[model samples]
Target: MNILVTGGAGYVGSKLVPKLLEKGFHVRVLDWFLFDDNIFKDLKTDKLELIKGDLRNSSIIKKCMQGIDIVIHLGCLSNDPSCDLDEELTKSINLDAGINIIKEAKKNKVTRFINASSASVYGIKDENNVTESSKLEPITLYAKYKADLEEFLHSQASEDFSPVSLRPATVCGYAPRLRLDLTVNILTYHAVTNNKIVVYGGEQKRPNIHIDDLVNIYLLLIDAPKEKIHNQVFNAGFQNYKVIEIANLIKSVLGPDKIKIQITEDNDHRSYHISSEKIKNTFNFSSQFDIKDAVLDLAKAFENDLVKNPNDSKYRNVKHILENEDFINNKILG
Candidate 1:
């Protein structure tokens, strides 16, 4: 099968693209290469095609849709803070650009159109586990757009066009293109480098999944029967942990004596415990990696110097965009 993974050089995509190649799928990547493109250097096999361009470009989107059987749309502004930076830009890329991709994919006869949505679309929920059918309460601009896209895709789903929306948890663990901005990852980084973990709103519950498991879910979707996945929205997540609980796990992994935990007030109060039972029951899909495994995976990455500078803004999505405002502004506005 030939697959097009938009934002294929990103945190999850960097790891997923290679796996897709190993499975003997022809993979084409559409990315701006805002971060390093070198993540694909080692895996640049004959089956992999990397295209550097913005998703807002129609010509590029059309080029990417050519000869594509499946379109795994992972391209977007990503996190809440990053989308908050520019609402207009976020709407263009996340919502408008996504609509274009879906339209082209359906027009070109693509079999599967898997969208990367976020569990943050649930916003602040009660202690009960939220399912895919739960009411969506997107608080942030980022999640609001994700929810909007999901609704639009659902409306467009048909017998020919299989659109699957995955509301993934906060992805944690090390990827080829590492991101230290996530809760588990950021805490692990600070614990290793600064000997302290700054945690905000210890009581806020955040759903998390290992990066590998998150990628695996996408792979599963590729092989899943059309009847099972078509027009279905699944909340993909493994475990739910409070902010302080994640810090404790990191301390446990890196040694409690070596790491100190500090609590701070956080402005962002969005929290929800997502349920993955529907997907698991339907497809028999369950995550293999746990939270501790993710912590240890990150620890090993730091030990090997794969993450030399965890403090670098490039490793953090919001920080990187904020630092390169002028460059990003030109790409979006112009």
Candidate 2:
């Protein structure tokens, strides 16, 4: 199978593209190549195609969709902060540009359109087990865009065109292109580097999944029966924990004595939990790695100097977003 993974050099994509290659699929990575420019630089493979282009360009979208069997649409202003940087830019890339990719993919007869949606679309849920059938109350512009695109993708689904949406939780773990901005990662990074973990409100509960498990689900979707996945939306979050629990988990993994926890008084209301039972029942998939694994994986990666300096600007999404405002608004948007 031939696959086109948009934003294929990113944190999840960096881990996924290589696996796709191992499975004997001809992989094409269409990316802006800004954040992870060094990720796939040394790869010398005949089966991989790397195209550095903006997704907003219709020509680029059409070009990438050419012989693609599956389109893993991971490209976008990924997080709430990144999208909130500029509403127009976020909508342009996340919503408008994404539509272009789907149009071209459907036009070119791509079998599967696996959208990388966010579980954040559920917002601050009071219910314990928020399933895929729950109403979407997107709290941020980033999530609103995801909900909007999911609407368009489902409407576009047809007999030959299978558009599946995976509303994934906050992913955590160590990847080739590691991110320190996530809850688990940043906490672990602080524990490893600063010997401290700070929590504003320790009671907030957030759903999470290991990067490995997330990648495996992508592979499963690639090979799933069309009937099972056509226009299906699956919630992909397994682990649920409070902010303090995550901080303490990091403390346990990376020297509890050395890592100190400082909890400040604040009402941090950003808590969300989701049920993955539907996906589990559907794909016969279960998570092997948990919060401990994510912490240990990141700890090991830092110990081996794999992520030599987690403090680097490239490792933080918000850092890059703030620094490149002009470039993103002009060049990337254009």
Candidate 3:
């Protein structure tokens, strides 16, 4: 099997590519290598190929689509603030470029196209546990783009070509491209390094999954029955907890003396607790990592300085890096 993974040098991609190569799949990574190529430079796999190009480049995408069996589209203008930085660029990459990929993949007769969706699509709801059937109420540009593209991908799938969207929850786990911006990892890093955690909107409910579990779901969708995966969108969260609860859990792992929790009442337009019963039942998938383990592992990574000095820009400034034009341009071309 030959798989093309967009953003394959990223946090999830760096990890997923190795797994794919280990399982005997010839892997081709299409990435901008925004910060540097140093992140995946050490991957000593003979089957791994890197294509540094932009997604909007139809010519390059056409070349990538040739003879590829599966398309794992993980490249995008992720996060609300980043989209807000440049809406036109975000739409082009997140929505327009994605449609182009689908069109070219279908033309190339690609077997499977797995889209990386987000739970943010179900925006600002007070519901306890949201399901796949729930109506979308996207409050951010990032969420809106995800929801719109999901519909677009579903409408484009045929019998021979399958398209599935995994609305993964807030992913937390150690990776070659470690991200300190995520809630779990950020809190753990702060606890381990700074001995402090300042939180806001403690009442907000959010669902989460380990980065390891999230990537496994991508692999699972590949071999899942056609009737089971085609045009199907499933929430990919393992557990749910209030914001305060999560902070307390981090405190438990880092010890009371190592952390301080300060909460403020700030109502954000992004809040939704997701449910994963649909995917679990449909594909017989279950999460092996939980919050307790995630916290412990993240603390260990921080203590060892594994993610301390990243070679790439994605883990640089969680805020600035996400909203950087240089990063977006790199993703488009790679």
> Per-residue lDDT of 1-334 in model 3, one digit per residue for the tens?
8999987887788779888888889988887765457777777987988998888889999999888999999987666776887778889988999999999999999979999989999886777789999999888899999999999999988889899998988888788777767888777777776778778887777789998898788889877878898888999998787778889999977797758898777866356788899998987888998888889888777678777564344574346455566764544443
Q: How well is each residue in 1-334 modelled by candidate 2, as lDDT tens digits?
A: 8999998988999999999998999999998876877797666789999998988889878888888899999988888878887788889889999988998999999999999999998989899999999999998999999999999999999989999999999999999998888999989888888899998888999899999999999999999999889999999989889999999888987887878999988867667789999999998999988889999998899999999566677888767877876646556532
Compared with the true structure, all predictions reach lDDT values of 0.88, 0.90, 0.82
What TM-score would every model get versus the actual structure? Answer: 0.96, 0.97, 0.93
- Per-residue CA lDDT of model 1 for 166-262, tens digit only, reads 9999999988898988889888888888899988878888889998898889999999989999899898888888888999988987897878999
Return the candidate ranking by TM-score, descending.
2, 1, 3
Model 3 regions lying over 4 Å from their true place:
310-313, 316-334
Q: Model 1, stretches more than 4 Å misplaced? A: 265-270, 325-327, 330-334
Best by lDDT: 2
Candidate 2 stretches greater than 4 Å from native: 332-334
Candidate 3 clashes: the total is 7
Return the clash pairs for model 3, or none.
Answer: 31-334, 53-333, 53-334, 54-332, 54-333, 54-334, 55-332
Model 1 lDDT-worst window of ten = 325-334
